[model samples]
Target: MFARVAQEDFSQQALYDELCAHDQRSRAGAIVTFTGRVRDYNHAGAIDGIELEYYPGMTEQALAQLIDKAVKRFSLTNAGIVHRVGRLANHEQIVWVGTCAAHRQDAFLAASFLMDMLKQSVPIWKKEWVGEQAHWVAAKGSDDDAAMRWLTEDKDS
Candidate 1:
């Protein structure tokens, strides 16, 4: 399952509980969860806050395809991703991913894959509000390199 919200807040405990509840009936032995939070600092300057914008239908479709790829590549039993949009304050939750698999390795790999792919392929754009100015954040080459690691190499290698 996948969900995206344009709200101002989310509950970490609630999300964790929901992920576990949804995967309880599965025969998987391992589950991995990842949560990303907004920090106060960026390379350019100190960010007071951030506003995320996404192309509604296209963004969701791309993310779903990414998740499907991760599931197929890592042999995951279940996977869930939630990304929050709109204005976000420092220390606020930005994204979450949960993966379940019969083995720990697959679960871990799937979780990593989801994050990396989301960073690279998702159509979400962030505008950082620093002091009294706002600037559009550009995608870093480092992120492309990180995502390429998974796309170009096999895990065992």
Candidate 2:
């Protein structure tokens, strides 16, 4: 398990390699990874960049908890999450979630679950730059809906 809230940019290949390193011999048949990027457009206007902030120790602990939940729930072999803080340009990588499991379903679902939980529960905050003005980004209803779906499904199971 690896969870990091970094101030600098991360390489996708480096993360992927680290994820696979712990699971050799094809023990974990599936590895799923997700990368989120800072988009050029948002509800406010054309986004030039974003300033991301987080509560130091609390942020890392929250992320570790999310990874632990996914690992136990999905029976994953390994998991990793890396999120970038500070100023990020449009189209720059903002977040990465990776999961490994013996089967594809577990790996895929765990990766998705990690991302949804990260969005909803992580303490990181974002301020978007729209030309000369900057606005704090708020949690979206769609994100809430997406995160809630997992809870409902878990209950049904």
**For this target, which candidate reaches the highest TM-score against the unseen true structure?**
2
- The CA lDDT at 43 in model 2 is 75
The 0-to-1 C-alpha lDDT of every candidate, in the order given, reads: 0.84, 0.91
As a TM-score, model 2 comes out at: 0.94
lDDT of 2: 0.91
TM per candidate: 0.92, 0.94
In candidate 1, where is summed lDDT lowest over 10 consecutive residues? 1-10
| Predicted candidate 1 versus true structure: per-residue lDDT over 79-121, tens digit per residue | 8888889988898989988888899999998898889879898
Q: Model 1 TM-score? A: 0.92
In angstroms, the error of model 2 at 133 is 1.6
Lowest lDDT block of 10, candidate 2: 148-157
lDDT of 2 by residue, 1-157 (tens): 8999998889999999998996675589899999999999987567899999999999999999999999999999999999999989999999999999999899989988999878899999999998787889999999999899988897223
lDDT of model 1, residue 101 = 89
